[model samples]
Target: MPQDFVKIAQRGELMPGKMKRVDLDGRRILLANVDGSYYATDDTCTHEESSLSKGFLKGDTVKCPLHGSRFNLRTGQVLDDPAEENLRTYPVRLDGDDILICLT
Candidate 1:
């Protein structure tokens, strides 16, 4: 498949254990920095419309602030309750110092 990767942020823009919410092609994507690795997933919570970037990051899991739904950043799997369906995950990569995310 042809990948449409878009550079969303610089490496220095996001610190470890931090996350940022970006709007790409009118889609809400949550970019997370777990330790030194980068991960991307849907920004909206499955149960509620809360932004996952506003939530807390614990290891590779992110806890939803609204209703406490935890999701794995790497696999976008729901690790805790409140969310039945899994969030969509995107491929993330680095080019030099630019953080790129695959939208296709």
Candidate 2:
């Protein structure tokens, strides 16, 4: 079977209220740590093609730097206007010191 979960980050590498961008197998994924919980989503913004990892993470919401659009990190749902499409989310889990994200 193919690998289900891919390692995204290490513990302490990403703190609460922070987001990071990871590239794996030509895929760009946005990883966010909200209140000690992890969430993964597409790094590209739905509004503008700006990088969401460069955006701001407030609580469970992320604001795009290009158009200031906000999205829920947990569900990839847009919390603001200007973005009609929702982001694609991935399942995240912590395995020891490894922060894994399911791309499958």
Candidate 3:
């Protein structure tokens, strides 16, 4: 069963072009605000197990600091080489002034 979407943070907490790491029921999630929408994905880079939240954010993409792997924040797809798997993405929604992440 899919877990209900939980409020991770306030909308104002994560600014555009910034990434924040949050623990969702023991799962590490990368919460990013691109433009004005919020997105949630696995915090760890698939290829190197590095923290994607600690990486640099360029527009809607995040560059992995370990191997320079770039991932699309919206879809969690690897846009560059060296990453063999797509990042795990979670459903996100805005609830009032809070950002809700679905952990299914």
Structure candidate 2, residue pairs in collision:
none
**Which pairs clash in model 1?**
none
Question: Which regions of candidate 3 fall more than 4 Å away from where they truly are?
Answer: 1-3
Per-residue CA lDDT of model 2 for 11-102, tens digit only, reads 78988888899998788899998899999999999988899999888999999999999999989999898998999999988899999988
> What's the TM-score of every candidate structure?
0.96, 0.94, 0.94
Q: Which stretches of candidate 2 lie over 4 Å from their true place?
A: 1-3
In candidate 3, what are the lDDT values of residues 8-81, reduced to their tens digit?
99988988878899987998999998899888999999998799888999988988889989999888899997
Please list the C-alpha lDDT of all candidates, in the order they appear: 0.94, 0.91, 0.89
TM-score winner: 1
User: How many clashes in each candidate?
Assistant: 0, 0, 0
Where does candidate 1 have its weakest 10-residue lDDT segment? Answer: 1-10
